[model samples]
Target chain A: MINKTVATLEESVAGIFDGATVMIGGFGTAGQPAELIDALIHQGARDLTIVNNNAGNGDIGLAALLKAGRVRKIICSFPRQSDSHVFDSLYRAGQIELELVPQGNLAVRIQAAGAGLGAIFTPTGFGTLLAEGKETRHIDGKDYVLEYPIKADFALIKAHKGDRWGNLTYRKAARNFGPIMAMAADCTIAQVNQIVSLGELDPESVVTPGIFVQRLVRIQHQPAASAA
Target chain B: MNKWNRDQIAQKVALDIPEGAYVNLGIGLPTRVANFLPPDREIILHSENGILGMGPAPLPADIDPDLINAGKEPVTLQPGGCYFHHGDSFAMMRGGHLDICVLGAFQVSRRGDLANWHTGAPDAIPAVGGAMDLAIGAKKVYVMMDFLTKTGDCKLVDTCEYPLTGIGCVDRLYTDLAIIDIHQGQLLVRELADGLTFDDLQRLTGVTLTYQPAH
Candidate 1:
């Protein structure tokens, strides 16, 4: 019985101390582990660093976590959007730090962290201001900038289904960063829509294999009273 | 001459796209190009958030909570549409797999330099997501924007003052006033808007231009 199922979101996300580096899986709210995020909020971990694609949207999920002053910094590709007021206010006020990365670079950097690579050379932001302060090298007459891996202490991810052994499958585009983030983190906690018995998940269809996941929690879709 | 409306500009850009091209319609005005794409043409739409073969905006009832473009707007998946991991999608972009990518720009230089994702203003919000990859990776990079800023300053400049998205990456520029091509460091006029002339566009642009009508 290779069951990795935890009793609750809080138990699954336990041992996340302050000043932790956490990777959140999502593009906006799609693949976000809302239950895990809510639990982290209630657990009141502070001074955390978060890595994701975007900053946050509306006042729910990651936005709520940031609004609660839990996050000390964010490393993301796009931190500015119409719906991300919380990040906007905090960033403008110099309360929260931001490390803006290019989208492709962000994805590959996380992938590198998972694959045990120290660094990678990508051509995505070669001549731009984003490439400033980074090492640049020419390979076959084309410029490539060096980007280091982005590993995290814990990864909070969302999935459509997960077996007791932690084999995970995501829904549609919602699978954006979940699989990569799971591999890039030391302990990956997945909040899933359903938890099945071992051998229930089709190994062929498993997007994130049980090897990358450490714990799982069946999500209860109850929205919090408020985070604003 | 009356400036082309946003939809008209999108329609013009849509007309120039060839059949069987794989295109990534960027956020903002470029996203409108999908609505104008001819139904008979089979252009695959790619969104950087891992969606490919995307369709136009879905109706209220047909909106799928899980399916969305990079802009986070709900969209329909075409018959052949599929989604993948973000890493794989970006590999397709940076690996030069896309045929074309249409993006909105703040400024485009005579040498086809792009500067769109940010302004150097102190209070400006910095958001550089996938523009750099698209600019350098796509086979053809097209920019769709107004010829000039609202205050009447030319967006097509001799040199970009803002941060560069990619070095000499733009192939064609589709603006309300004209459609121009950047060839060998020259801005070649392909088509002028109705009631606009070569001299008038040259004056408004404040840059050197040569007229070579599209055949």
Candidate 2:
């Protein structure tokens, strides 16, 4: 009776509106939910503000989404990479906006959103150019910069396994931002390799609890191109 | 002067790391340090993406798309390794849980300010991943880079002209020509490449240098 598994990828991404702030989990392509992103592309939500570690790699997934011209802004720590040509061009042509935060700040800010903290004082960017124009505080002899939480309307993540209850477990380094993003978003949509039966996943090992995830879709296979 | 090659510099950095040290190697040159780490030492490598106890690059047959380093390259997880989320991963760096972090830099001021993330070029797309956190968070920040730019300008400067990654965070600097330590705003020469004199090192560096070899 507590099923959250959706029938189709379209249904999983349904109800996402234009101008929504979306968090896509991944550090590069490791945990990127390519299938869910492809579905979102088809869903046709425009002017999205995306939050991720990198913009995209090569001409697929987040890059394909960016190439679709649906994103208006990207809030990420690093958007420039050797294969990030799509974001690079879009950024240079003044087609999209970028808010570059330090990697730790990005993670903690998202964590802060989920944890419901008003603001945090982190020493990661203290006294650096990134700290310029931001609030600063001296705490116990060390300078700290004030950063706010980054809450998203939706979070699209990939996991190794999940149940109908939406409890999830991630594999290896692919777990990157999935767990925290699931908590920081209003609606967390997850794509998993398999949907195990109830109580199949060990309660102790469940990374993202059912309380955080809203929808789950089992991706039977990864697209060959995206897998590489 | 018999300048040390990149691998030698990396090997030197590896030699400095003690056993049981937890180290994070930045992408590119810093990653080379891993190859030269003493076989006897049990050094745990941390990747900012969400892996601890990271191993070297995997063989082509062992490549797993899901398991990659911060550079997005396929890597192996060492025994006793663990996977974590970005929140916990960054927390490890920002919480000073890391013993050492070696990073690549564009410029490092004599005061130990780091400038590697951005060149301040208006046209350049600035992407600063975990550089700032590693710069400020690690107990010892070791920078590995070329002593001079390709065009013959010193990278070690009196003051960083580009956008800073972190201020006064670097402890030791390992360059091709010499190894220097930043202590209380003094650039103390630790070791120089064979046949490289103190004056020769000073002539190449933009900042003043003091000869104080490590014991």
The global C-alpha lDDT for each of the candidates, from Candidate 1 onward, is 0.91, 0.94
Poorly placed runs, candidate 2 (over 4 Å)? none
Best by DockQ: 2
Task: Write down the lDDT that model 2 would get.
Answer: 0.94
Residue A85 lDDT (model 2): 97
The CA lDDT at A113 in model 1 is 98
Assess the local accuracy of residue B53 in candidate 1 as a C-alpha lDDT between 0 and 100: 89
Cα lDDT, model 1, residue B70: 89
Clashing pairs in 2: none
Q: Per-residue alpha-carbon lDDT of model 1 for B1-215, expressed as tens digits?
A: 87799999999989888999999999999999988999898999999988888887789887666788988888888888888898999999999999999999999999999999999899998999999999999999999999989999999998899999998999999999999999997889999888999999999876899999997
Judging by lDDT against the true structure, name the best candidate: 2
Docking class of 1: medium
Scored against the true structure, residue A135 in model 1 reaches a CA lDDT of 99
lDDT of 2 by residue, B1-215 (tens): 79899999999999999999999999999999999999999999999998898988889988899899988889999989999999999999999999999999999999999999999998888989999999999999999999999999999998899999999999999999999999998999999999999999898876899999997
Question: Model 1 reaches what TM-score against the true structure?
Answer: 0.97
iRMS values in order, in angstroms?
A: 3.0, 0.9
Alpha carbon lDDT of residue B187, candidate 2?
95
